[model samples]
Target: MDTQCGDLSAQSISNNYSTTAPPEPVHSTGAHRTEGDENAGGFGELTELPIEINERRPTCLCCGRPQKVCLCPFMPVRPLEVSTCLYIVQHPAEESRVLRTVPLLAACLPPEKCKVFVGRRFNEERNPELAAVCRDPKTLVLYPGSDAENLEDMKVDFSASVHNVLIIDGTWSQAKDMFHRNALFRLPKQVQLNSSISSQYVIRTQPTNTCLSTLECAAITLSIMEKNKAIEELLLRPLRALCSFQLQHGAQVHHSKEHLLRNGIYDKPMPTNKRKIKRMEQLVSNSTL
Candidate 1:
């Protein structure tokens, strides 16, 4: 996903810790020695030039944000205990986004409760664990489609056993590509959240008004699985703080593309592709209805 605040390009933080050795000092040869060195009766040794250090903005180890705008304070004092496990199948691009919400979602939950896998392809041979989870009857994939069951209306017995929830963290197009490419995703029970609430991730533009961020999706899924509404609010605390901080720091509030199109306020150029043009027309028609 290319989610970010203020149109900032994606920033990557290197995890490698290998230290580079300083370069060897240059020694003056007899032929290259200056006249001053001859007058001093000794070879003038060049002082070692100081190595330039690459200075980066100080970042918080926990939330992965700059220290000055750390979101740790907004996180829960302790990890929230939950029976439902979240498996976030993230796109490779999301790992480089600076203002992603996945970190916030993970920070609010127990380490084991939230597992992230980064890749576009998954199979039983290479991803046995994920494959097993997908085969389990208790597993549910949060994806929207004509066949997907509504999460709000689905009935499940939480007392029987914990459920595994698979969420694809990417743009709509990327997510759809992954879902279609991987047959394992179709094995799980497909589900969708039909909540009417608008997204709280004001810093990033969404495809539609009902579209939610990865964090919001997880929060709602967990709250429903655990049968506790409080989980949703707890998980969203850091996200709310993050948006508030960004808005205060000059980040504009971005409305959804659907909203802009419906109101005739969309200033961007219309798509040239016939398929895209039809999609846009459908969005405008649906919004009116």
Candidate 2:
């Protein structure tokens, strides 16, 4: 696999992500996608927003909900049973968006167990850490296959061998590109997320029934590997939080108060004044409460 694109994945910082809260989910639903909405950027607007890089809430371009509270866990978890090391190769575009679970998994997962490789091409020599695993006699990069394990049975052969699963986090097309471009897969046994779900990206739409968000994949993989239940909670929390934040923020932006109309969007520039900031924070706290 080309290692250059894979290694340089973490090229940018998540937008407005000052808090440690689990990321909110994005990717609007396809069922509700009207022609007008599709024209608004076809879910890319929701998925590509760098909402997480900043501490403020990210309003979904579709439903205007916090990416976390979009209310649809469209992405499903694809658990795999493996006997080697696991790595996730993500497309950089996935990282550019704040509501992305791929970036959060990279940030939160234990470094010793899980590793993230990002970019269009992964340069083996450029990433010594990934190279060490790639060079390992038993490393594997996961690609969807007809022979892949069935996740619905929740059957992870319960092995003692250190198994690694590399999940490519991105849209179905982008994921396919990652698969074709990388040379890292030749290292070990391959795996893929159980393809039984319709995807949980609430603000984006995917054509495949097998697609899953990055967090769901990671949560299932961890459950299979270490049998930790908290991973599920931790992984899904961000999505909800993001959804909730966006809803609140969007409401503020659309507030019918005289101040907005008089000032106009971007003209008066809503005061970032301390009092207003405090009011917004209080509102957020009260809503969550």
lDDT of each: 0.81, 0.51
**What tens-digit string does per-residue lDDT give for candidate 1 at 75-158?**
899999999999989988887766788878888889999998989999999999999999999999998888899898987776
Candidate 1, residue 70: lDDT = 84
Every model's TM-score = 0.81, 0.50
Give residue 230's lDDT in candidate 1 (0 to 100).
96
For candidate 2, write residues 92-150 as lDDT tens digits.
77656555555444444445555667777876677777767767654545555664554
In model 1, state the lDDT of residue 90.
90
lDDT of 1 at 130: 95
**Candidate 1 runs further than 4 Å off:** 1-54, 287-289
Could you tell me how far off, in angstroms, the CA of residue 188 lies in candidate 2 after the best superposition?
A: 2.5
RMSD of each: 6.8, 23.4
Task: Write down the lDDT that model 2 would get.
Answer: 0.51
